[model samples]
Target: MNAAPSVRAVIARHCRELLADPLLHGDPTLRDIAAQCHQPLRVLLVGNVSTGKSTLLNALIAGPLAATAFEETTSSVTWYHGPEPADPVLPDPGHRSVTTDFPLAGRVMLGDSPGLNTLSDNPRETLRMLGGSDLTGAAAAFVCVLVGGRVDQWAEGLEELAAFSAGPFDLVGNIVAVMAKVDEVDEAVEDIERRVSGDTTATFRFAAVNQLMAAAARTGAVDDRIVATLDRLRTLPVMHGRSAPAWDRLAEEVGTALPPGHLKALEQVVGAPAWLPALVAATAGMTTTGAVAEQFERMSRIRSLEAVLSDLADDSDLFTSTAAVLRLRRLAARLKPRPAALVRARLADLTATMHTSGLHRRAAARLVRHTDVGSGLTEHERAAAQALLRWPDAGADGGGTSDRATAAEVDVGAVLARWTAYEADPFRDSRSREVAALVIETARHRLRTTTRQEES
Candidate 1:
């Protein structure tokens, strides 16, 4: 039986054809880019060491394929895909890739990337997986899984999010943030949630997830209340004429039955009280059907993340395919004994068409940071652009905020004026004139874009 080659494979094949062509035998860069393009869309689980990144993947796949410990568990880049092979496949002596029929394996490959700032070779590996170098370009989106209530840790992940940007492809547009260990910061939940939701950084869809609670409720301890809550929700009409009691209150009843330490533990890793009922409902049976697995997935928010990934897959398909075509056609045009003039003209037209397509400009604009002007923009200016660009979609896609949910808005002109009058004067770093000009222009563009979006 013949099977279709994957998008990456097609790119690789094209590269081979081009390489073997008598007319284009000299250039190797084109071959290298084709090989890099062969990489599948790798969804990275990025964060600091030991933030339950691997454990969360295990819960997501409903298997313990990723080694998990209280400390840094992932040692290298591991890729997971569907349809288990007879044995493991290692692409390189240093890295491993495996096939498993996990719920998400079929749609896209999942990569468990070590913490980007780890002490070992992990950071280098993380960058390579994300295509974060000159030789490689990104064919991936990020799921920034962070431990609860730590702005510092979250900042580290955001650094990776921004770092993924290169040239005209803005991989940051594909990021989906996950607040891990939601249960650990009970006392300051409101404040921390405020901090995260309020962050002025890039606005991307986010989920406050407690993979531990989701896993525990489904596979480990069964709190009677969790079961009870699930049963109640199942019985009621999803949109009853009247309101239903809060699910957390129902879970609290189950919490009461457990020992104080156990209850505390439950509270430590439990996610939004809203998902409690669904978590228990997920594993209420000896075996799970597709429906049950789906329910569990939603409660775990893994399904939510998967849905996001699926949409991103479509986006990735468009972006990467167009990028591949443009890259190759451009190379072919530049090759010695280049194609017929008509063929070259068509290639240029096709490349231009790809550049102007949907979301392409906005995505490219995101790469401004790689430019001298963008890098010179003050941190405040850059953040302002992020908030403005994201406000329209972020409100819709990013999960609802709690008491601290309101976006901590920024005011740039006011900030800039202060900089102008600062005690020592700002921008005395020798690029003062250049920095100010870029900052003003960037802020103006951001302001106009935001205003136009709001009006629409």
Candidate 2:
């Protein structure tokens, strides 16, 4: 027998069937939903005022789509659609949407939300978006920006937001807490990570990033012109200071190499002079724009953020499918009897199709991250399960030859035996047993695939 179809394929197939079905045909909302099934995963960026939400959004999409400044800039949620366009409106005027040529358009789209903890009513806008029940025009994942050393203060707020952002089933994969502008903080990223390591309520992964550095590197702000300015600054004796030189004194020293207009622009691009000496020292001999950008990118610590995004993107299908299913279920509730019945029928078929693969992946993620459920397993077992959960290209239709080659080496029988026994344990909690059964199905699929390959 053939392997089960991927969640996306199943959704797409059903979408076609729905459009052709007499009960659902000509429904604009259903058409919109059909189109969204094929679009990239929508990931929203949100945080407190001036926490670098816009800067991080620009960095992620490699464009200055959202306005950024010291004061509150973004007043509403703006969805940055990928190369292809989908529904722009979120059924609310507070939200705005635009399309761009971001290289990762097919894999992920991004949304920039107004900051929280502000004096103005901006916080309410963000809260309203998060509070909505309908997944229509909703983000599948979220990157919550927080300033360094403020994790403790915002821990409670973050937990509340996570409840709404992360889906009913997902725990860790759907949300990420990012400490933006970490360069300004005295403490290191590792220090912050260790600080929050014990916070059980914050289920998402943590990353500390210098949004300015990442934005500069990504937006090509660190070009040869900036390098020349840096080189000129290095020659001036006054530039080497324990504290940054005053703006007036530095302007005099700069003289003609950097005119007043150019100097101010440079200030905006590279940030304060306190970190320029470090940048000059880091890129000591680099001469080209690409070389400078490379050095700056390394200094940015942006790769850590990128790696997190890459892992999230690898599981895009899971998020997309989950969001789509939830969206359809909710849509069905309010529809008329005929269309509602058809939608319910289609949703059931979709669920039965993806039960083993898509649903099980979500269950495994939840089981691994749940403190109580995870603790029930041995350390070795937990680690193995996590490794398998994060294992790249575990989806049915997609992995490369290397992925299959690696899978061929796994002791599938041993994996099946262990998880199967865990599922059958009478002492296990009903919740744990249910999740374990899902995990066992995942293992069984792997065993079957491995067996077929070996037979071939």
Candidate 3:
């Protein structure tokens, strides 16, 4: 079988066909979407004051391109893309654009906005990028929301920002909540994940990251001087807390080996005195710079954050498609009766035929990613749902999709029944019911496909 056309290609084809219909030819909204659908997967990093949003952006790009400081340094919206601008002709003076070389530059566009809930005009600048501006629609396809020290306060701000950008579709799928500066807090990463996931007010997935260390690891901040200093410090006793005196003692013990000004620099690189001991322990026998950087990378937990971001990025096309369809619907609702009917019919046909099993499963997974959304689901029911969404073609035993195409005949009927009932329940929130509806469709399709395979 031939490969399916990309989501953008499909949308472009439909746009051509619909524009020929004369009714949607000059529609402003349709024209805007046609122009913007080609934009790269736009990911915006947003948070309250000093949540390490800039630091995280620097880490992601593997450079210190974004300015980082203890205070609010990012005053304006800075957009980073590869050498080529996603939309060069667009006139949006509110943002500062930076073109650079980065791994994901060609595939994704990264935006770093000013912190929200600040004393100055920072919040307004950020709000504009989040779709409060008069120029265009929402700037980002997905938002990486950062939460630091005070979770409740940051979450409150996030809730308000989420409300402002709210659309007909639930924005939960378009969000990824990041608990930044996890090392600064006393709570374990797992505990932090559980705590954030338990918050019913937020519906996005969660990740715990140490942005400083992650940047250090990615940017090669751990040099030979730092490694030698760590090696010298390792000769002495292990330090306990992050108190100033303990660090002073360690510096004094190393004496002439660690110079007066170098001690402060070492502290700056390693983040905290507590991390010195852990780094010494992590690189007990290591001597090379690469070895030390690898250890620091592992301790940074940046990989976990990258994985979460990668999952969202992989579904960029689907998210863009969904947004475009929603825009078309909203536009259709505003048109005259005859024009609106034509647009609606074309949209309905495109949506019904455009989505594939993989896209459908991904959409379903996003809906139920946080377990709270599927609270009423049984353990077995949830497992089956995971299997279907994650590895639909794999056997019940579990393996890569390429390894085998064993029919996942387990719990299909039960999953269909339960999710169908959940979708019909009026007491559930619209978002949960929407999730149930997607899962139900996926289950019904899977059951039919499995039966056909069995017969063959």
Q: Highest TM-score, which number?
A: 2
Tell how far residue 110 is off in model 1, in angstroms. Answer: 0.3
Tens-digit per-residue lDDT, 1-456, candidate 1: 111223444555555665676655644545554544544455667777877788777766666578877776677877777764333333334667777676655455677878766678767776664553321333346777876556555565565555543224344445667777765555343465567666646545566666775565344334443344344444444313233235455345545544345434434345444444434445455233344434544555555666667655534543354445545554554555554343355445544652333233324233332233245457665555434333232322222223212223657565345333331345354433333444444446556766897999
Better of 1 and 3 by TM-score: 3
Which 10 residues in a row give candidate 3 its minimum summed lDDT?
Answer: 395-404
Q: Using lDDT, give the best candidate's number.
A: 2
Q: For residues 1-456, write the lDDT of model 2, one tens digit per residue.
A: 243455766676777788898877865556655555566777888888888999988887787777899998988888787656565534244567788766466567777888887889877777754655454435667888988556787778677766654454544567778888876676656787787766645667678887787788788787656777767777878766665675567788888877446666556666656566777677777778788877777776778877677666766666766666766777788788998998899887765653434545644654565445646567656555544543433544344223222333445566567767887778888867766666666667766766898999
Looking at model 2, which ten-residue stretch has the lowest summed lDDT?
A: 399-408
Structure candidate 1, residue pairs in collision: 183-268, 184-268
Q: How many residue pairs collide in each prediction? A: 2, 0, 0
* Residue 28, model 3: Cα distance from true site in angstroms: 9.0
Q: Residues 142-243, candidate 3, lDDT per residue (tens digit)?
A: 455565434565566566655544343454545667877766676667787777766547555567877787788778887887777777777775453443
Clash list (residue pairs), candidate 2: none
Q: Which candidate, 1 or 2, would have the higher lDDT against the true structure?
A: 2
TM agreement with the true structure for every prediction: 0.53, 0.78, 0.75
Clashing pairs in 3: none
Give the better candidate number (1 or 3) by lDDT: 3
